[model samples]
Target: MKDKQVLEFDLIIAGGGAVGCLLALSLRSCGLKIAIVEASAYACDSQQSLHPGFDARSIALSHQSASYLQQLGLQSSLLENCVPIKQIKVSDQGHLGQCWLDHRQQRVEALGYVTSQQQLGTMLYESVKDADDIDWFCPDSVSDVKQHQQHIDVILSSAKRLSASLLVVAEGGSSPTATKLGFQSQVQDYQQVALVANVKTDHPHEFRAYERFTAQGPLALLPNADSSFGLVWSLAAEHRDTFLHMQNSEFLQQLQQAFGYSVGRFVALSQRNSYPLALARLARTVAHRSVVIGNAAHTLHPIAGQGFNLGLRDAQCLSTLLRNTVKQDGDPGAAPVLQVYSQQRHQDQSLVVNSTDALVRFFSNNHGPLVAGRNLGLGLLDLCGPLKLKLGRAAMGYGGQNAAS
Candidate 1:
C-alpha cells in the first residue's frame, strides 16, 4: 500500500456496534483522531435496515450506564424512547423463592432504563457523526489486524489499510478480526438458546421487569415504552424449535404458564428470534498495542441483563484512561496504558461474568436440595438490607471501586 493511500488515526475501533459507537462518542472531545470500521452500513435512522448490532432487540441499561451516556449529552435523545425500570421482581417457577428490588430503596429514580437497540444506535451515531476528530467507516470491516511495536495496521474489506496508535476491538463475540489476531477466549455453552420478542400484555407493565427461572432456564420480561414487554426466554436447545415454531397463542400460553400473571395475560407477540447462550471471555483483554472490549472481551449470560451494561462499563473505563493518556501526551496504545485499563476492568468483568454464570447454573437446576437452597437464599436476599443494597449497587454498575481505579 502506498503511504498516502494508508489512512492514519490515533485510535481505530474494529466494530460499529453499541459498544464501539459509545467508545467513539465517549472520546469525542478528546481531540484524538478516531475511526470506527463497521461491517454493516450506516443504518441508525431506520429499524428496517438489517444491522448486526443495532437490531430490533430491546436492551436494558443500568442506571450507571445511563449516567455515562447522559454525560456524553445523550440523555435527552435517549430518554424520549426509553422505559424506566422502577422495580425488578425475580422468582423461580413452581417455587416459593422470590426477590424484589425497588429503585426507591436504592434512593434512585429508576434502577435502569430499557430501549430498543435501534433507538440507542441512532442516539450514539448522531452524537459523534459530525465530530471533526471522528471518522465512521460504515459498510466496511477490518479484514486483518497486524500488531507492530508502536502501532497496529488494519486492512479493511475494501482493501484499504489504516494505521493507528491503538486498535480497540468492540466487535461482537463472533468477530473474525479477533480470531485472526490469535486472541484466545474461554467459552462455555449453556446448552440453551434465548428466544426474544416483544409481547403485548392485558395490563400495563408499570415499568416493572420480571425475571422468572423455569425448569428450562431463565425468562426475563422488560417493560417497554408502549405498555408492552420485551421477552427474553431461555429454553433448552432441544425445545427451542418447538417454541419458535409454535403458534402465537401456544407460545403465549407456554409463557403464561411459566411466568404466571404478574403482568396480566400475554395478549400478543411480535416475531421471535433465538440465539444460543454462552459465556465467552478473552483469556487476555490486552495484546501488545491492541485491546479487546465489549463482547469481544467478555460475553455473559443474560440472566441478570448485565451483558450490555458490563460492556458499557468497559467502554467508559477505557475512555477515561485514554482521555487521561491524551492529556498527559502519552501513547494511547502503550503497554503501560493498556495494562492499566486491563487491570482496572478485570474485577468488574470477572464479578459480572462469574456471577451471571453462577446465577444460570444455580437457578436453572431442579434438584430438590439446590432448589431449597436457592429459595432460602432468595428469601434472605430480600430480607437483608445490606445484602440487597450491595447486590443492587453491583447490578447498577456502581459497586466496584476498582473499575475506576
Candidate 2:
C-alpha cells in the first residue's frame, strides 16, 4: 500500500503537541486513516536538561481529566511522575476568609495531579508511537494550506502536499494554521506575566495547593512530590521585566514575603521563566474542513491551571464524537457532524473560558471594595458545607456534565 508520489489520509492534524498526539491515539482504535504533522523534531527525553521545552510550568489536572487519561491507558505512565493534589486552599493574603477543597469529599483518593509540561508531552508522544493509523511526520511543518469543497490540502515545508477530509490545529498561541482556516481570536492583554519556578520546601506541603491573592495578582504555589513546590506568580506586565531579572535569592525572598511561612524555607530553586498571560478565544470552533483545538482555540489565564486540562477535554470529546460517527458509517469531517460536536461541547468549554477569564479579573484588582467583597465571599463559602463540596467537585473538572471529549 505504499504510494510513490503522494500520501492521502482521512484526517491530518497540524500540531502534534499533547492534544494532537492523544487525539490521534484515541481515534486510532476506530476505523480511520490519520497523519500527524509535528513541527518539532523529537517528542520526548527522560533526561530533564536534554529536553528544551519542559519549562517550569506545571499542570493541575482535575478528576474527570484523570479518568479520561485512565480510559486512554495513560494513567499508569503519567502517575510515575505525577504529584497528587489532595486539596486546594484559596484565600486573600492577610485576609479573614479562606476556603479549602478536599479531594476526600469528592470520593476520590486524589483531587488531581501535577506534572511538568515536558513530561506530559513526552508521555503523550510515547503513547501514540505505535498507533498504526497515524503517520506521524515529525520534524515537519505546514508550509501552506488550501481548502476545497472536496478536501483540505496542506503543503509541507519539504514541498510535499498532503490532503485530508479534516485537520486539527494544535499549534501554540495564535496559530497561523488556525488563522488561515478563517478562525478569529479575541485577545485580552491581561497586562500580566506568569513567573514560574521550582523550589525545595522545608514543610511537607502535604499535597495541598495554595492560591493567595496579593497586590500584583494571584500568587499560587502548587505542590509537587517530595519536599518541593511549583510557583505561578502573576504580576503586572509593567513590573514583569523587573521580577524576571531578579536573582534567585532576591526572587525567593520576595516569594517568601507573599507566601508567608507556609512553605517553610524555599531552597535549591531552579531558574525562573516569565510568560505573558492572555485569553485568546476563537470566534468559532470549526472552519472549512479544519477545526482548532488546544491553544489554537483558546489560551486562558493560569490562575486555575485548567488551560492544558481544558485542551485535553477537547481532544477526548472530539475523539469520542469521531469514533461514534465512524461506527455509524459516517464521514467524520462532514459539516453537520462537526457542527454537532462543536455545539454539544460548547457549554463546558465556554464555562472554562469564562471562569478562567473571570477569575483573573476578579482577583487581579487591588481595589479596596473588591478585596473586601472577595474575602467575604470566601468566608461565606468556607462556612457553607454543601457549597464547599460543590466547589471542590467543580474545581476537579466535574463542574458541568462529565469530562467527555
Candidate 3:
C-alpha cells in the first residue's frame, strides 16, 4: 500500500474476539481513533461459528467481571441471557470433606454469572459496530508490526497498512502477531484435556455450580440459562479419545458414577468437544509502543474460571490509563503510560496465574497425603467463616483489590 493509502488511528487493536472487542468498547468514551483488525469474518448469526473464539462454549463471569461490564453499560443487555451462580459446591469424590459457598455469605447477589461466549461476543461486537470513532478490519489479521519511537505500523493479512500510536494484541494466548513482536510466554502443559458439553439432568441446576475433584481431575457442572448444565470434565490426555468416542449413554453412566447423584442422573448431552489445558503467561505485558492484553498476555487454567475475568481487568485498567492520558493530552503509547498499566496489573495477574496453576497442580493428583490435606483444608474452609469469606471474595474477583479500576 502507498504511504498515502495507509490508514491512521490513535489506537489499533489486534483480534476482535471478546477481549479485543471489550477493550475497544471500553474506550468508546475516550474519543480516540480506534481500529480493530480481526482475523475471522463475523457472521450475523453466531451459529455459523465464523468467528474463532465466539463459539458455543460457555464462560463464567465473576461478580467483579459483571460489575466491570455494568460499568461499561453492558449488564442490562447481558443479564437476561445469563444464569446467575447463587451457590458453588466443591468436594473431593469419595472424600468426606467438602466446601460450600453461598451468595448470602459473600454478601453479593450472586457469585458470578454463566453465559455463552458467543452471546458476549455478539454483544460486544454490536456495541462497537456503529461507533463513529471505531473502525473494523474483519477477515484480516495483523501480519507484521514495526514499532517506532512515536507511533507503530501494522500490516494486515489483507495487505492493508495502518499506523497508530499504540497496538494492543488481544488475539489470545497463541497469537502469532505477539510471537512476531517477540513476546515470550512461560507455558506449563497440564497433560490433560477438558471435555466440555451441555448436559441435561433429571433435576434442575437451580443456579448452582459444582466442582468435584476426582482422582483424574476436577469436574465442573455450571448451571446454564436454558436450565441445562454446562459440564467441564478434565481428563488425562491418554484417556481423552476413549471418553470422547464413548457412546453418550455410556459416557453419562461414567459421569454419573464419578459425580454421584447429587445433581440427579445425567440423561442427555450435546456434542462433546475437548481442549488441551495449559497455563501461558507473559513476563511483561508491554513492550515499546505495543501492549498485549487478554489471553495474549496470560492464559490460566480453567479450574478457577479466572481467565476471562482477569483479561477484562486488563482492558479496564488500560482504558482507564489511556483515558487519563487523553485528558492530559499525552500520547497513549508513551512509555510512562504503558509502564504504569503494566505495573498496576502486575499484582492481580500474578495472583490469578499463580493461584490457578497451584489449584490445578494440587487438586489434579491422587496422592494419599495431598488428598487428605486438601480435604481437610476444604472442611476447615467451610467451618471457618473468615477464611470462607476470603475465598468467596477471591472467587467473586475481589481478592486483588489494589488494582481496582
Candidate 4:
C-alpha cells in the first residue's frame, strides 16, 4: 500500500462559504500558509451555480463590515455591484408607530449596502485565487480531525492528510466536523421560516430599506441595484408552503395586503426560496488546537439583517488576533490566543443573538398588552433623537465598543 501524501499548512479552514472565504482572505497579510477544504466544487466560472450559500439571495452588509472587507482589498470589486441604503423606514402595520433612520443624521455616507451573495462570494474566491500564500482545495472536506501536542492532523475525504498549527472551522451551523468533535449548540427554533425573493415594483426604491412588522411577522424590503427590492418575509412555518405553492398573482396580492404600498405596487417577483429561522450557538467556541468562527460558532436570527454582519465581525476579530500571534512567533492555536478571541467575541455575539431573539418574539406576538407596549416603545424611539441614533448605530454594526475589534 502507498502512504498517503501529507501536506502542511499554518492554518486549515473547513468550509468555503462567505465567512470561510473571508477568513482565508483576511489572513492573507499574515504571511502564514493557509488551506481551505470545501465540500462543494467551486469553479471560478460557475461558483454561483455550485455553491448553495452563494445563490440569488441578497445580503445586507453593514458599514463596519464593508470597512473590514476594504481593509482586505475587496472594496472596488464588491462595492461596484452593491446598492447603498441611505435610509431605513421601520413601521408597524395597523398601528400609529413608525420610525425612520437616515444616513445624514448619523453623519455617514450610507447606513449599509446590499448585494447578492453570489457577487460577494465570487469576489472572495477571485481574490484568493490571485494570492500565492493560500491553497485552495475545493470538492474536498475534512473527514476527521485529531489534535496532537504540537499540531492538528486533518484527514481529508480524498485519503490525504494535512498538518496545521491551528484548525479553524467556518463551515457554518450544520458543520459535521463540529458535530463530530462533540460541540454542543444551543438552538432556539423561532418556529418561523423566511421567504426570500427578488421583487419589482411600480416605483423605484430610491436607496431606501423598509422593515414592516405585520400580523404574520417582519417583512423587509432591501433596495437592489437594478431598481428592484430584495424581499425577506418571515411567516409561520405552516403558512410557508401555502405561499410557496401559490401562483404568482395570488402570492403578490397576499403580499400586497400584508405589506402596504410603501414602495408602490408589486408588479413582479422572481423565484422564491424559504429558510427555517433559528438562533444557534455552539456551547464552546475553542477546544485544543481548533476554533469555530462565523455561523459555525453562532447563528443569529435575520430580524435586523445581523447574521452575516455578525459573522464578518467574527472573521475580523479572529484574523486580527491570529495576525498578532504570527508577529509574536506565538502558537496560533495556543490556549491564551484562543481565550482572548473567545472572551472578546462573547459580548458582541451574546448581544446580537439575544437582541434578534427579543425582536422576533416581541414583534411577532399579537397580544393586546404586548402590542400596545411595543407600539409605545416604537413611538418613543422615533421621537427621541439620541435614542434613535443609538439604536440606528447598533443596527449599522457600530453600537458598543466591544463590537469593534
User: Which has the greatest TM-score?
Assistant: 3
Give me the runs in candidate 3 sitting further than 4 Å from their true place: 45-47
lDDT of 2 at 121: 70
lDDT, candidate 2, 218-322, per-residue tens: 988888765588888999999988888878888778877777786678766777888899999998888778888888898999998788878888888888888
Local distance difference test, each candidate? 0.88, 0.82, 0.90, 0.87
lDDT of 3 at 405: 53
Per-residue CA lDDT of model 3 for 1-405, tens digit only, reads 337888999999998989898888989968799999988888876458746787787889999889888889887887987889999999999999999999999877899999998788888888998999999998888888988888899998889999999999999978898898899988999999999999999998989999999876899999988889989899999999999999999999999989999998899999999999999988788998999999999988889889899999899899889988999999999999999998899989989999999999899988899999999999999999999999999999898845445
Question: Candidate 4: worst 10 consecutive residues by lDDT?
Answer: 43-52
Candidate 2 vs candidate 4, lDDT winner: 4
**Model 2, C-alpha of 24: deviation from truth (Å):** 1.0
Clashing pairs in 4: none
Model 4 has a clash total of 0
**Model 3 reaches what TM-score against the true structure?**
0.98
Name the lDDT value of residue 121 in candidate 1. 83
lDDT of 4 by residue, 252-359 (tens): 998899888888999999999999988889988999888888898888778799989988898888888999899999999888998998898888888888788899
The local lDDT score (0 to 100) that residue 364 gets in candidate 2 is 87
RMSD of 1: 1.5
How large is the C-alpha RMSD of every model relative to the true structure?
1.5, 2.2, 1.4, 1.9
Q: What is candidate 3's CA lDDT for residue 46?
A: 40
Report the lDDT of model 2 for residue 183: 86
